[model samples]
Each structure stands twice: as C-alpha cells, then as structure tokens.
Target: MWQKVIIPFSVSFILIGCSEPEPLVEPSTVYQCAALTLTATVTDTGLDIQLPDQSYALVETISASGARYRDDDFAIEFWSKGNEATLIINGEPFPLCIEEGTLPTSFSARGNEPFWLASLTGQTLTMREPGSEQELTVEAPRLVEDEPIMTWSIAAEDGLNLMILDQYCQDSMSGQSYPYTAYLGREGEKEAGCAGDPRQLLEGVTWQLAQTASEQAPTIQFIPESNVAGFAGCNRYRGTYQLTGEGLQFNPLAATKMLCDETAMAVEDEWFRQLTEVQSFRLDAAGELDLVLADGNVIQLQRKN
Candidate 1:
C-alpha cells in the first residue's frame, strides 16, 4: 500500500515538473490591412499624419511605450504594433496612416539661416548642416510634430536625440499658422533641391540596357523636363514622366504598332511592364542606373553617352 501511494505521488510530481508556464508577454494583435507609407506634417498648432487611406489629426491620450522625440517643452511618441502604428504628442494620441509605397530617399530644402536638408536610405537618416559640409547621420526619425512649428526627432548614438525644427508661419490675411512644408521633410512632397535630379544626370545621354527581366538590348532617351522616349527590342515607345520624391510615375506610353519576332515582342512586353512598374531609382557605384519597382524588381541601365 505504501509503495502504491508513493508511486502515485512521484508520478504526479513528475507531471507537474514537466509542465511549462505561460508566457508573460501580452497577446499579439491582428491589425487590419493598410498602407505602410507614413507621411508626417506639422500644421500651425498640431500635427497631421497622412495615412495610406485616411488622415489622422493629433488628439489627447494616455502615455504608451514606443519611440519618443522630445524637446525642452514638448514630446512626441511613435508606437508600432504588428501592422498598425500610432503617434503620441505630449500625452496625446493620434492614429498614424501607413501605405504600401516607397519613401523618399533624399531631399533638400532651402530657407533662412539654417537650410533644411535630409536623406533617408534604408534605416538611416542623414541631415546636412546648413552652410557646412558637416552632417548628422542617425537612425530614422521617429516623431514629427507641429506645436505651431515643425519639429523632427531622431535617435542618436548618444542618449540625447537630434531635433530638427521648422519655424512656423502665420498667414497675414487669415492669421492661420502652418509649418514650412517646403522646408521640412514632407512625405510625397518633392522639390528641386534634394540629391540633384537623377534625370538631370541621365538626360542628354543614351541609356543601353545592361540588365533587365528580358535579355534585349533596348535603348532609351530622356528629354529635359517631362519627355521620355525609348526603343524596346523592336518597337519605339514614347511616354511622359512625372518625378515625385524618389520615384518616377510614367504616363500612358505611346508605342508604334508593329509586328515583331516572338522574342522581340516578348522582350518588349517585359520592357513595358518594367517601365510602368518603376517607383524609385538609384545610381550605383558602378555608374549604372537601377530603376526599382514596387515588387522590388530592378531595371538596370548603363550610360552609352
């Protein structure tokens, strides 16, 4: 009898020892599908973030854990969980809009005294100091706010964060204040100053296909301003282009109606698809131009000038 009782007790203790405890982390949330692009803007008195589908203005809320951008008088926090993100300003909360789009990699703005210059590549943010070659390269900015003036916060190597400010302006006629959007890093907002127009460097030169989805030696010519014409394998095509941020949006292309060999037509189809899908571009160290698409496809072209 004692043997049976001790055996049962030993089995129970063994089972209990083998059991595991529950995790201490909070349950993960499933967020609704939305865009990932975040556009930050500072208005006269508050902040406005343009999301993929809608816009959210800043409002009051309790504090939450996330990235923080702080100044002497104000603070902004950015929280990202799963597929969603929120912006908090001075204890206030606001929904952050996100979209599936490419962010601008480089931009420059000119204003009084300190010139506003910024470039984002991958996870890095580089801010060029005004009138000097010196620059502050840090992690991507986490918070952007307009307390009547525009401010940006980036995490630095040191404990202190780097802050960028854009002075506010009041319309004399209406008296409504607004941040200098032209001088700040506004999403989808493109001006002439940033990393000099990539087209300006590509213009006046013939580009021969170096690498593409189709193995065809197509050629292209980019006229100054908004005109671009190219030959895809056997067909000559023309289209207008609009540059926004670091991406190029192409108008409906006009191509000559002609019959070609099967290989050439296949190549042409691939070329047209590549052109339409192009969203951003970069000039590699080899001096080759790589036009990137939303799906991460790349059309590589080499200068034949």
Candidate 2:
C-alpha cells in the first residue's frame, strides 16, 4: 500500500531548444574606381571595406536606390548599384567606381602604333589589323629559353610565327602594364606588342623579396602551365605548383648545381625551406605578394617593375 501511494507522486521535466547557425559571408569583391581600388566584404548586416590607405566598417543604411552603407561617425559612405559604386569620404564623393572584370583565360596581345590585335583560343590563332583579319589553326606554343628571357614560339601555317616573351611591358598610350612582350612574324615582317594572360597575376611578372634584406634577394617567376623558375640566392631553381581551393602548393623543387659562399648558400637554403612550407598566397593592397607559411610566418615579395 505504501509503494502504491508513492508511485502517484508528481514528476518534473526539463526542455531544451536550439537555433540554426548563421550562414557565412560571401567572398569580397574588388572594385577599381578611377585611380582608386577598393575591396568590399559583405557581412551579415554590414560591410567591411579596404581602401589603399585605410580600412573601414560600415552598417547598412536606407537608400533611395541601390545599397548604401555608412559608418556611425559618417566619415565614410559606400553606395553601390550593380557593378558600379561611389565612395564618399568626409562628404566628398568619389564617383565612377567600376568593378574590375576578369580577363579571359585565352592569351591575347595588342599593339598601338599600327593598331594590331592577336589572340589564341584553343587551336585557333586570330590576328587582326586595320582592315584585315586572319585565323589559323596552330599547334601549342613551345618554350624556348633565349638567354635572360623565356620565349614561347608558336608555329602556324603559311610561314607565320609568333614569339611571346615572358617579360613585363607597358603600353605607350594607355600606360597599362602587361605581363608579356609579344612579337608577330609573318614572311619577312615583324610587329612588336604587349601580351598577357590577365587572369594570372603571378604569371610573367618577376617577383623579388620585399621583406627580407639581402644584397641579392631571392627572385621568382611563375610560368604558364604550373611551372615556376627562380633565382634562390646561390642557384637557379625550377619547380611545379598547384593551385587548389585551399591554397597554393609546390612540388619538390630542383635547383641547378651551383656552389657559392656560405652566406649565399645559407640564404638559398632558407628560401627553399620557406617555399616548401608555403601554405597560401595573397596579394596585399600595395600589390605585394605575401606567401603565408605553415608556421604563421610570411614571405613578402614585390613585382619587379
């Protein structure tokens, strides 16, 4: 009887609840407005901005048209419509902020004096001049080392040949920098121009050590097809690289057998070690390439102009 009465006693219970996690923010967008470049990262409720001089965080605000963001102090404001944006600093508007477009993966070149354009897509190579355009099916370009410069030679039908140098060039009129200097040869005539694969920032441009101090700083140049060649203080090295979703990785590097003093060899050894340990790479606002290592150290490099 006592057991039956105790069984009628009240019981207590506890309840738990859970909420969904917020989604991650999308990748940042780079915008080139006139002479200024800006990188904007959209957050859950606001924007993280990176200017050449400084960085700013702004909250979303009401706008008549397009999206607008402003800081609490009203020191900076960003207004965007489609791919265009206007940046306001201290109430002074900087308009015409056009978004930077990605360049095509196909190789392209252009010259100004005589107005010529050439492009290689797949097996077809197209050449265009003032009033003439020609397309020819050609084989892939062959690498030819011309001493200090690396050149890619393309042989086409009808005795047409095109040579592209892995060197930096600037347009005479527009003053735009190109990764490669190109020469188009047909019959006995040749035309010189600037060529590039604009999508590849590390390609063609020579990069020199920016942070480390040395009389002969280490240098690197990324070639097409995942090949990389560099001067590592004492000897020249060549290796392959892979660009994955996570980061950049280099295969086992091979260097020329050249002996030098202890100082140079030491520098070379350190550089090779760093290159092997690189986990990722990024370009800073100042257009310097930063190679992040697994040990949380950074190897900075600048474009050799």
Candidate 3:
C-alpha cells in the first residue's frame, strides 16, 4: 500500500531569465493507487494507446489500464518475452501471444506509478479461445488516466523597454525601401500626417523625422506594432527582433519567396543586416523616427498601418 503526494499549485518557484510565468491550478480530485486495465491497439500510422487521439507522440499503439510502454530513454523497467505474454490481466484476457520477437519493452512515470513497465503493442500475445470461431486476436494497449503529460509555454514581456518605428524610402528610379522601424516607447492612439502620408501605427499616432539625409528621403504610413511585420518596401519580412542600449539586432529574418531580381529588396536586406549597431532614435516636426546606425548611416522609418 502506498500514498500519493499532492503538490499544491500555490507553491511559488523562481524562474531564470523569465520575468513572471503563470502557474497551473492542480486538479481538485486526484487518483489513488488503484491499478487500471488497458489494451494497446495498432492503427495505420499512429499509436492508439488511449486518452486522446494525439496523446502518445512516439508510440505505435495506445495502452490502457495495467502496464505502459514508451520508446527508449526512460527510467522504467522494461522486458520483452519474445513479444509473447500471459493474458492474466486481472479480469481482462488471459494467456495471450503478443508479437514478442519484434516488439520491445519500455515505460515512463505517470499518475501514481513512478516507473511501470509497458506491455502494449507488437508483443507476441495469445489467448486460449477468444471465441468459438477464432483462437486469438492481436490486441493493443489502451491509454489510461495515469498517463504522463508533456507541454510547453512562453515567457512574459514585462519590465522591458521597446521602441516601435516604421519608415520607407523611395529612390529617384521609383525603387521603394524601408530603412527603419522600431517600438519607440509609448502607448497612444492618435496621429498627425502633416508632412504628406507620414507613417501611422496607432490611429492618429504618427512619428516624423527631425533630420534627413536629403540624398534619400523615406516615406511613412503609420499603422500599428512595428515595421518587422508588414511590407519593407516591395519586399515582405516577418521574424523576431531585439534592441539593446548599444544597438539592435534581428535574427532568422525571412521574406516571401518572390521575384526580387531588383536591388531595392537586396539593398534593404543588406543594409538592415549591416546596420546591426544602433545609437538612438530621433523624431522630427512631422512626427517620424530616424535610425542612427554605427557607421553613421541614418534611415528614417515611416509608420504604414
């Protein structure tokens, strides 16, 4: 006889590199040490061991009740009796011939069981008399309530300073480009496009540039969020970005698979990657943000919602 430990969900834990991650509420009711019986059955391309359709990720069949099975890399005790076994599964079947030789043994901890071996699927199991017409039929294990769970979660975005900018430039040859886009540190909903179609992120919220290169002026269309999401000139890019006191850097930046035979998009990618080092952001009378890179190259970002 054994007792199960109930871990309260209220327990606080310190997470490294994460600000504040939410916790899950433990179930009000928990299962006892009562062993359950389950059958593992094989399907076309998946393992139907029990629980839910997508429950077992790497098994050939699902199992229920008694024993369990998993791939290698587990701490549970495993055994393979030529894939054959006795059907003495409590009140279930008895003396069964499982595909013993081809099947392997595996297990994992779930529910109250710390390390239970698996007896499901591919085992050489047989029964005395399944029915009057048949001697024995191959059976799979059924997934039970005592199964394990594997999940993932994302971290919070708190106490972090961010700048949102959006800007596009057009060459005399009609070529379009986006020099800069960032989160400037504000949460407002308003705008002013006094100097032509200035970029707009929030409704009525516009950012103008105080300084310009003259040789190349950028156009803006204020939308929401930052410039990483939408079109960067004729090209489109979507990925993750990071900004520090020293500068900004983007990674795994990808774009649509289209005809970029022109140099605008190419220049846009190269220039953006090269300008990994940023100094600061400046605004103009028209409500726009300018990007100051390490090499002294500045690119004005326009908001294009």
> Model 3, range 40-118, lDDT digits (tens) per residue?
4444443233221223322322444333444333322112133433222223222222331111132110111121111
Model 1 Cα RMSD, Å? 20.3
What are the TM-scores, per candidate, against the unseen true structure?
A: 0.38, 0.38, 0.25
Arranged by TM-score with the best first, the candidates are 1, 2, 3
Off by over 4 Å in 3: 1-227, 245-247, 274-279
lDDT digits (tens) for residues 1-305 of candidate 2: 45544456787877778789887767899976533568999988699889766799999999999999999998999998866687888865553465555222257888777888888886688989899999988877777775688777887887888788866665666544565788888779887887864324565357888855446889988765677888999899998988653567789999999988888888889999999898777666686777889897989998765
What do the candidate models score in CA lDDT, each in turn? 0.52, 0.76, 0.31
- Please state the error at residue 27 of candidate 1 in Å: 75
**Per-prediction count of colliding residue pairs?**
7, 0, 83
Q: Write the per-residue lDDT of candidate 1 for residues 102-191, one digit (tens) a residue.
A: 112333333333344555444455556655543445676444665655455545453324444443332232222222233333343423
lDDT of 1 at 218: 83
Candidate 3 total steric clashes? 83
Compute the lDDT for candidate 2. 0.76
On a 0 to 1 TM-score scale, where does candidate 1 land against the true structure? 0.38
At residue 47, what lDDT does model 3 achieve? 26
